[model samples]
Target: MQNYTKFGKNININNIEIAVKTRLGQPHETMRNGVMKERKKPGLKKARKASQFSKR
Candidate 1:
């Protein structure tokens, strides 16, 4: 893939500021959102409850 419009040349991206306001970063938020979504899905609760019974 061509990085620039003229030809296939690597572009300099040295000034990129990589961070988030909180310490955990955006990835943590995304993962937390996914878990929350899965918990809300149908049949998920039943499966989890079944696992709890096996731990007894």
Candidate 2:
């Protein structure tokens, strides 16, 4: 069988089974990564980060 572990292809079936059992089968959550990125706010520099200000 193909190696599902991220380590390498030298892994055995037992190790693969254990990895699957432990829920480490695949690294990526889904086929498309970062598809649901948070939208930046209208006023904020970033999504939630605002510009820094200082009082003289």
Candidate 3:
């Protein structure tokens, strides 16, 4: 299992689970920006890297 951050919370979109990081009132550009910001977080990046290495 992967650890989910606040920005990468799973949401149901059209019956599919998608990871979104923006607020409901935010614009589309905000969603992109939010994902970019989330990607820059060291903790999240580290967690992702760790998960990848564990899969080997």
Candidate 4:
């Protein structure tokens, strides 16, 4: 907590750290949705063998 003083007001440093990571999680979750959509596209392999034989 003491080390966080450099970022947050020295007296409230620990408080700021608490919300730092929580605020970033929202964008991460949205990126997952996009990633899942792309993975579902036919371009990606569903299995190792499926991908190898796909060209055939």
Candidate 5:
């Protein structure tokens, strides 16, 4: 038997139980720590993008 804490809740798993085989999957790292947006750089159209060039 094993104990797991998920979403602030306690869960128990038995070696001989089918629930053990269908255990929950872990959340993504970003999800666990919260997602953050990248800051845009100076003198750029976007974060890492620039204006298009025109050659005539």
Candidate 6:
């Protein structure tokens, strides 16, 4: 089951919780090269792809 916190800053899936943490104040694409972009979690990435495929 997926649930959101009161403020909706993070997400809880099954028993694993993942927070939507962003880099700096702006998106990484907008920055030149301050720091490497935040890599997406493998499990979350896979789940996202699966959800997209299911939507189609």
**Pairs with backbone N, CA or C atoms under 3 Å apart (clashes), candidate 3:** none
> By TM-score, who's the top model here?
6
- The per-model lDDT (C-alpha) reads 0.35, 0.41, 0.43, 0.38, 0.33, 0.42
State the lDDT of candidate 6 residue by residue for 1-56, as single tens digits.
Answer: 23323323332333122222221223222222433355466899999999999999
Clash pairs, model 6 backbone: none
**lDDT of each residue in 1-56, candidate 3, tens digit only:** 33323444453343122233224322232244334323355788899999999998
Q: Tell me each candidate's TM-score.
A: 0.29, 0.20, 0.32, 0.21, 0.19, 0.36
Between candidates 3 and 6, the one scoring higher on TM-score is 6
lDDT of 2 at 12: 47
Cα lDDT of candidate 5 equals: 0.33
lDDT of 5 by residue, 1-56 (tens): 34433322332333212332334432222222333223344756553353344321
Model 2 lDDT tens row, 5-41: 5533454444544444345433322213423223344
Any runs in candidate 6 off by more than 4 Å, and if so which? 1-35
Q: C-alpha displacement of 31 in model 2, angstroms?
A: 22
Per-residue lDDT tens digits for candidate 1, residues 4-53, read: 33211331232111222122223222224223111254588789999999
Model 5 CA lDDT for position 19: 35
Quality of model 4 by C-alpha lDDT: 0.38
TM-score of 5: 0.19
Which 10-residue window in model 1 sums to the lowest lDDT?
A: 15-24
- Candidate 1 Cα outliers beyond 4 Å, as residue runs: 1-39
* Model 5 per-residue lDDT at 22: 32
